[model samples]
Target chain A: QQQVKQSPQSLIVQKGGISIINCAYENTAFDYFPWYQQFPGKGPALLIAIRPDVSEKKEGRFTISFNKSAKQFSLHIMDSQPGDSATYFCAASKFNTGKLIFGQGTTLQVKP
Target chain B: EPEVTQTPSHQVTQMGQEVILRCVPISNHLYFYWYRQILGQKVEFLVSFYNNEISEKSEIFDDQFSVERPDGSNFTLKIRSTKLEDSAMYFCASIGASTDTQYFGPGTRLTVL
Candidate 1:
């Protein structure tokens, strides 16, 4: 049972374009949604996170748009750069659980 | 900037041997966790440790696997008998009590033959 599902296993975008990755979850108990970026041979780094109370959060060029009613969230990267080419993973976890349920990763490629 | 640190970025061991992976989480963090990622697979949670004990563990964490916080700074995962299926990249993460964001270590790639 994959609690969180992500679409478009791979993505390609031109430089300065908007790169978008979408994720959905079935568990209503999930309150914390986060996006992680991982480069090859390294660990996943926290990119952006949003709580259920907020409809959207923007950090630098990264934005997370969350829709609680639809049980969906999406990550948008504005001005996508070639350096941003890597794997992105969306994760969800409930309070006090300390266990993150991750979605299938999306590999993004930005062509300069 | 505080970050999680792991030892032996890569380890190669034979089947039926014992291997212990070590991690040093951030100094101020209290919650610790272990996760594994197989080649081209999503990260899977193995166990979570809090208050000096395991709070939760996944079904994949069997009796052959064990986690211990031997000291104030070191968290270790020991696999009693390594199997070929245990080959994967193991990551350690830590979070503070006030935040839900987890900081991850650089991961250790374990290869079992």
Candidate 2:
């Protein structure tokens, strides 16, 4: 079973537009949710993260909207730029176990 | 910001040969982890290490897989008798403390032919 599932295997957006990616999870025990950005031939870099307690968290152009009851979360990029184009992955993890369950990645391409 | 470092960005080996992937996590980080991603698939966890010992591992971390922290800064994953299916990108990560954030390094891509 894919504990974490992401939608829109690929996304295309225009520069200065909004880019959104959604994810769902089945495990209620997951307390930590994080997003990662990866480029070709590189490891994923942490972008933004949130806990279930918070409804939303924003960092500059990146934002995370979380729904504890719905068991879903999403990442939104405001005023999306060409520099922001990359593969995005949503991941969930519980404490101590150190194992992170990742969703099928969404490749976001921004056209200028 | 100090980041984790990995060696040999890519490697190719014949099937049934042993291969070792190396990583150097950020200093002061207390926990270490290993993850792998096959091309066109999601990233999967392999194992976690803490206090110089393994804390947990996944079923995919079978007998052919082993991890070790042989020195103060080096963490290694050894795969014995690698199969073509073993070809993938291996990532190494570390968290500063139990409750803190985890950081990742550029992964090593291993190709078993």
Models 1 onward score TM values of: 0.98, 0.97
Give me the runs in candidate 1 sitting further than 4 Å from their true place.
none
List where candidate 2 sits over 4 angstroms from the true fold.
Answer: none
Q: Residue-wise lDDT of candidate 2 within A7-96, one digit each (tens)?
A: 889999999999999999998989899999999898899999998899999999999999998999999999999999899999999865
By summed lDDT, the worst window of 10 consecutive residues in model 2 chain B runs over B96-105
Q: On residues B1-113, what C-alpha lDDT tens digit does candidate 2 reach at each position?
A: 79999988999999999999999999988899999999988889999999989899998999999999999999999999899999999999998874546788899999999
Give DockQ for candidates 1 onward, in order.
0.87, 0.77
Using lDDT as the measure, which candidate wins?
1
- The CAPRI class of candidate 2 is medium
lDDT tens digits, residues B1-113, model 1?
99999988999999999999999999989999999999899999999999999999999999999999999999999999999999999999999988888999999999999
Model 1 residue A105 lDDT score: 97
